[model samples]
Target: MVFSKQVESPITTEFFIDEPTRAKIEYQNGKALMARGPQALHEHVVFHMEKALGRALPQMEVRFKDVSISADITVKDEMNLML
Candidate 1:
């Protein structure tokens, strides 16, 4: 599900400054669109991906879901080289 709205202000700075904690908002062509949360299938896939990565690379850290503000999955080592 995607929810979109038009705002009077520029979406760059102001959108993030007042963005809701749970909101995944995107800006496109002056429109503010809220992204839908992951579905069950997507979550399951991510979970398995995380597990597989962890097993494959025992020395690295495998993170899934909200690893960063814009990242869904991340693999990081002690040096943080592959981020």
Candidate 2:
């Protein structure tokens, strides 16, 4: 969840995520504010990589049977975010 008081009333936004979400939230002088959702950042990274490479990159996923697990693992070569 995120909160902002830049308006007359406080604004709240909620998100459901499967991965650890990255956020940039700032409050200036306890009034003005700024924030970005993790989804937005993910799209930005995907867009830039696609544009720079001139092609869409392949994506992968894996699953396990009879067991449940949650972990931060590396998918691609991006060291910034681990799945």
Candidate 3:
């Protein structure tokens, strides 16, 4: 899973990963957490990424959070671009 946010100033990127297919995100805490499932790893990764964004840029635009799979996830394939 992947997530992103557009911020002002010099643009940049960040990364994160949750352990044991689980993670806690400070932003949108409930929205992503609720997505838990068999593909928990994917969800956790996205959650981790979202939290990393805050660490990378405290003033970042967090509303842009996105999620997708590294492999071809037929279900969310269309959302890859959003990631």
Judged by lDDT, which candidate is best? 3
In model 3, the clashing pairs are: none
Ranking by TM-score: 2, 3, 1
lDDT string for model 2 (1-83, tens) is: 33311212123332323223434334463232323655555544655575699765565456578997799985756676667
Q: Against the true structure, candidate 1 has what lDDT?
A: 0.39
- List CA RMSD, all candidates: 20.0, 18.3, 16.0
Clashes of 1: 0
lDDT value, residue 12 of candidate 1: 30
Q: Give per-residue CA lDDT, model 3, range 1-83, as digits (tens).
A: 54344333445544343243335433465565455543554545545665777553244445454765487555656657673
Each prediction's whole-model lDDT (CA): 0.39, 0.47, 0.48
lDDT of 1 at 62: 50
What lDDT would candidate 2 get against the real structure?
0.47
User: What residue pairs are clashing in model 1?
Assistant: none
* Model 1 TM: 0.21
What residue pairs clash in candidate 2, if any at all? none
Q: Write the per-residue lDDT of candidate 1 for residues 3-83, one digit (tens) a residue.
A: 222223332311112223334534473233323444533333433464577632122335588565565787777896754
